[model samples]
Target: MPKDAMAQKRGGWIACPDCDTLHQCGPVKAPHDVKCANCGRTLFTRTENPLDRPLAFALAGLVLFIPANLYPIVTFSFHGVKTDNVLVTGVYRLAEGGFPGVGLLVLLASVLFPALYLMGMTYVLLCSRLRQYPGDFALTLRMTQGLNRWGMIDVYLLACLISFIKLGQLATVLPGPGLYCLGGVLVCTLLASLGFDPDLLWRRFGARSDKAGSWNLLKPKAS
Candidate 1:
């Protein structure tokens, strides 16, 4: 069954990040540099190694992710009333306050997606470092892409800052360890992305199927 799925997998075909132009780049060499024919945008460059800087940042992010979730984001002291808000508590309170949809979005954007992205990157990079192809490479790529897109820790941070500012008028809102840890995670995630190239996965995946090229993945797949 895996073989059959692998057989159907096609190779090549990349998109320009700038102008959305599609290019069919057959087989690229190491230091895989390719420019989009339409927009002159560099699509894929540098065949990344898992043991490089990207891996380091990703590992660091994973380490910080734990405390970011466990620790309190902020401590609110209002007229001798002390309330410490952890990340999960914030989500729970939001749901309990009749904003379940927003709470769910917050949970996914702030907590679940960020952790999944870090884990996914670590897994894929480690597997590549060991010269192992994932069971379903395309699915893994899609998952990571979705996770990356949804991981909105920055948004959460913004909301926290706004809350701090607004609440500070009437109460003392002290920044907690979780806030600092989350900042570290966000920085690490950005750094990891700067060095890691998902396109490198295509180079390895192309080995299995070379008869045709990948179609327009920008379009959503049919259910």
Candidate 2:
């Protein structure tokens, strides 16, 4: 039999997300992580409060996201005159100053993508907690996972710090409430993503892989 057919025969095999190596899935005690044999990437772990932990972090990230965008991220002072700028301001300024592409990139990376990610994650967690899968569950979940790289708030925050250091010699730059809030959002979103378990979601929701016609390892059994 082919490898895929062999995988089907194994009954409880899981493909490694990193290297596509199939490993038989077995229940393990808490505090132990399931690692991929080929790539050594962690596939799963017995988390005590999987849903609750990520849900809390997602909620916190959503809350902080509001203030992160609304308030000024930082303030710049030149010759005693000060000006504060929010997240969008930098994008607009970048566009107005002739870097429209960079502005749009920043807008998507810093503002748009983070908001979508937070909302998507919040919705997914809510549905998972309620044991209900909405019509758009799969699409939403896939998009949330896909945008993980595009949501670059951490990178944006680091850029802010670098700007602060570089501009300190010419003028004064101070952290604002929004900057702190953005930091909080970044931290919360990161924790939420880390704590989130896709396998758990698949098992609970009976999510099927559209690509793999015969793969149903995590498919929930009918009652």
Candidate 3:
């Protein structure tokens, strides 16, 4: 039998050679593996990393989250007057500056999103670890995925750097310890998210099993 035919006979994971799209192989699988439903990539063999690594990263991210939220994100000065702004303070400042929208956006992006991502991921990790079934693991997974992209502390840090460089001549702009902490938080959380294995979650949560009708696409092939 051809490789594709063989794949159909025995269930397995396949990656498209042309575009690296992931596909679950079996009789009950989605139609037409010839073109990846996600990226239109031709089907090919591929390997997936185990879930333990991502679980570790998720735990580390939880630890870093505390400091990320506690520390000051930026500091500013003008003509001998200086002020340090934590994440919430910055949002308030933005509102005071008549930029309520910007302030709310910043708060959502920096404060709200990161916290939600961290908490959500933590819950996923813990629940998975305990082998406890959540009512809506799929929904939680989606929220975590969405929040992960918006956790833009690095971008905000770069903006801080640019602002400091521009204002240094007129006023000093020194980075506080919190800035470093926030960076660590961002890096750790990013690593955690990357390390997390969604497949593992499904397996542990009983979302994927032989009884689930042979095969169901857990995650779409990445383009």
On the 0 to 100 scale, the lDDT of residue 73 in model 2 is 84
**Cα RMSD for predicted model 1:** 6.3
Note the residue pairs that clash in candidate 1: none
Top candidate when judged by TM-score against the true structure:
2
lDDT of 2: 0.81
Runs in model 2 with CA error above 4 Å?
Answer: 1-11, 208-223
Tens digits of lDDT, candidate 3, 1-223: 2433343355455556566766665543322324577776544222123345556666676677677667765677777788887767878888999999999999988777877887777778777666566687678877986787897777887887887788788777888777787777778777766566554455445543443245655787889
- What ranges in model 1 sit over 4 Å off? 1-35, 40-42, 47-51, 207-223
Q: What is the overall TM-score of model 2 with all chains considered together? A: 0.84
Shift of residue 33 alpha carbon in model 2, Å: 2.8
Models 1 onward score TM values of 0.77, 0.84, 0.69
Clashes of each: 0, 0, 2
Worst 10 residues of 1 by lDDT: 1-10
**On residues 1-223, what C-alpha lDDT tens digit does candidate 1 reach at each position?**
3432342234445567789886666644445667888877778665444247778899999999999989999999989999998788978999999999989988888889988888888777777666677687567766886777799988888888999999999999999999999999999998887677776654445542433444334777899
Task: Give candidate 2's error at residue 124 in angstroms.
Answer: 1.0
User: Residue 88, candidate 2: how far off, in angstroms?
Assistant: 0.7
Model 2: worst 10 consecutive residues (lDDT sum): 1-10
- lDDT measured at residue 195 in model 3 versus the true structure, 0 to 100: 60
